[model samples]
Target: MTISPDVAAVSTSRSQRARHYVMTRPTFFTVAYAINPWMDTTTPVDVERAVAQWETLRATYSTLGHTVDLVDPVPGLPDMVYAANAGLIINGTAIVARFKHAERDGESVAYATWMDRRGHAPVSTFHVNEGQGDLLVVGSMILAGTGFRTDPRAHAEVAALTGMPVISLELVDPRFYHLDTALAVLDDTTIAYYPPAFTDRARAQLQQLFPDAIEVSSTDAYVLGLNAVSDGKHVVHPAQATGFAEQLYHAGFHPIGVDLSELLKGGGSVKCCTLEVFS
Candidate 1:
């Protein structure tokens, strides 16, 4: 797909970085309960298809020169496969999630145990937080989300733990419950987002922070197009988000698409299934 002239003009070369990521195989992935809008208890999940798609995503990261670590899936915790929600790992320190919903509460401990085994200092939080789901690292700061899963009070806690400035962005739409679901960090200072997902104040903050950020179409946003992982250059995202992929390509990014349709039934995609381990 070709991009508009204005978009092409803004295209510039970006540096690529090799990253480390943690993932969990969908050994017990199923939608037996509904927490997010995309999830429905009545929906039948194809476990085999979900596993295959997750495998493809893992393989894609390996091909892109990134390291992949595995956290063993816990039985009966189906949503454990969405590893990003487990915790936010920054420079070898883990701030484990305090899940808001009881159904996913067990996943936090499972991930914390894995982090501890890996020599990461896992620290617990007092306020409710959903790890990378509500927290995104942008340049030298963290963009934190609230109004859905994470509590607003958790923002200051993350700032104190990481010693990084935290910018709280409130999510307004149920469909875009997490900051990662609505915004994809394209590079250290660049981002692509669905503006309507955030409140007016949050949108204003984003505009001031990233004036040239890509505004995604509503059609692509509904497909969770912004829920992507990027190592500065290559952006791994849902295969169905063709339009967003094109935008990434024109913006001088290598967009790699993978089919995670089965996992999407559980309200997660590429970024949700993968957690970046910064060191």
Candidate 2:
């Protein structure tokens, strides 16, 4: 059937207005001075460096117009990133996550409280899986990675919990650990990833998801914190992401690099240390 002029224009506008909604942890929201794994057991210079890094990241994000909400770091949980993992923002409300590590199990309560105070509540929760960090949101499907931090059960758990299809891949390197660690969905049309992080099948699926994804290298990927919030054409990589910075610049992303020297000692990089909630 042919459409009227007004109806056609309205339909096109609605289609173009569609945008991806993401939940990111404001780097400043957490008690990183006491919780970042980089401190290990804690030291003089370590604490000082962590504080500076956190402050700078907080200011950077604030300047970008994102609202930052500070949350009390779950005492004794070193993986505060897990707290951000607790809620998966979909539609609008937060979807609480079932963290694999016991160290972060308490976030369910902490985040639930945070959401409650903000006049939001979690609609559902996973007893066996984490957030979309391991689960990449490409189009309508969720590509989740299994092994290492993410258990095999996490795959079925997340898929069943969220009512979304899950494609799971084995971890290529224990070091890279999380899916976001070695890969990033730069845009619906592009993904920034390194080969070492993907399997043959995973790579193929990624290609199918976004054919225009520009391939980056592990060297730069590691430094840039590949998973540190891609897309939006604005990348917040670590100061060390030299090669990736150039790539981001070429791709039209304003790459803002923050110092992360202390984080390296904890076996985590920029992405691991911080949670980014979208505005």
Candidate 3:
């Protein structure tokens, strides 16, 4: 029996794509403006602290031996510090985002320009989507978040572009606006999630898909424990999520903690700042 050329091509591409993460330096990072429920105009952000935290995360990825690519941060776009919202990239194809809010809409152009220069096929989105901040890839499936930052229409667009099935999950908690904040894809078969962040139906869907997933506690969730980044081995997460870190250790995973208190003011942490750029 022989496989068709199209089938063989897809198999080869999926097998060969290199794994990498994209980051934008928090050069002018701040929460001076409010867009989401997380940001408050009265709340002050420590720019120096945010940059240091971001640098640590970048170095953590470098120390883990994953390629850390940098995208130029545009002035006046303070939220660009959260690079994961830029777009979703898989097999060198980028599905550029169309932000639900005007505040972040300009980000799509910047990310598209970067993708073009990097030689990736850039596909612009029509419906509102906040990029990987609401889209997570696990093994061969995509877990997409909606009911807040991303629109359901964008999920279909993503599936069409990547040629993979997308499981749409509705977010219920405003604080965990993006799926990346409410859930973390630890490995091909494991995930860490906060139950309260998702609606009942969406929570059930996750339970069906990842029955043995690590259920994060409310305390951990408060500190953004679910917003973690893992390379199938080492997990980088917020230091404040102490209990979750211990849980990761007992579960046979190495968890490294970093303080991102400053950025937390803007409702983002480790995963928010890191975007996986699938080769």
Cα-based TM-score, every candidate: 0.96, 0.75, 0.92
> Scored by CA lDDT, what does every candidate get?
0.92, 0.58, 0.86
Query: TM-score of predicted model 3?
Result: 0.92
CA shift at 205, candidate 3, in angstroms? 1.0
Per-residue alpha-carbon lDDT of model 3 for 1-279, expressed as tens digits?
Answer: 355576455334322223598999988787777777778888877798888988898888888788988999998888888889988989767888888878776778888898899887688878888888999999999999998889899889899888999999999888888999889988888899999899999999999999999999999998888889888767899999999997776565678998988998888999999889875
| lDDT of each residue in 1-279, candidate 1, tens digit only | 676676556554577899999999999999989999999888898999999999999999998889999999999999999998998999767999999999998998898899899898799879999999999999899999999999999999999999999999999999999989999998999999999999999999999999999999998899998999999989999889999998888787889999899999999999999899888
Residue-by-residue lDDT tens digits, candidate 2, 1-279 = 455576555334321111332222323232334322233444423545655666676666666665556667655554453333555654454566666656567766776676677665665543455665566665566667766556667677666656777788766766666677677765555567776777787788767766766677767765536756543656667778778877766655566777766545544555554444432
Structure candidate 1, residue pairs in collision: none
lDDT of 3 at 86: 88
Clashing pairs in 3: none
Task: List where candidate 1 sits over 4 angstroms from the true fold.
Answer: 1-12
- Which parts of model 3 have CA positions greater than 4 angstroms off? 1-18
lDDT of 2: 0.58
How does residue 12 of candidate 2 score in lDDT?
42
Residue 102, model 3, lDDT = 80
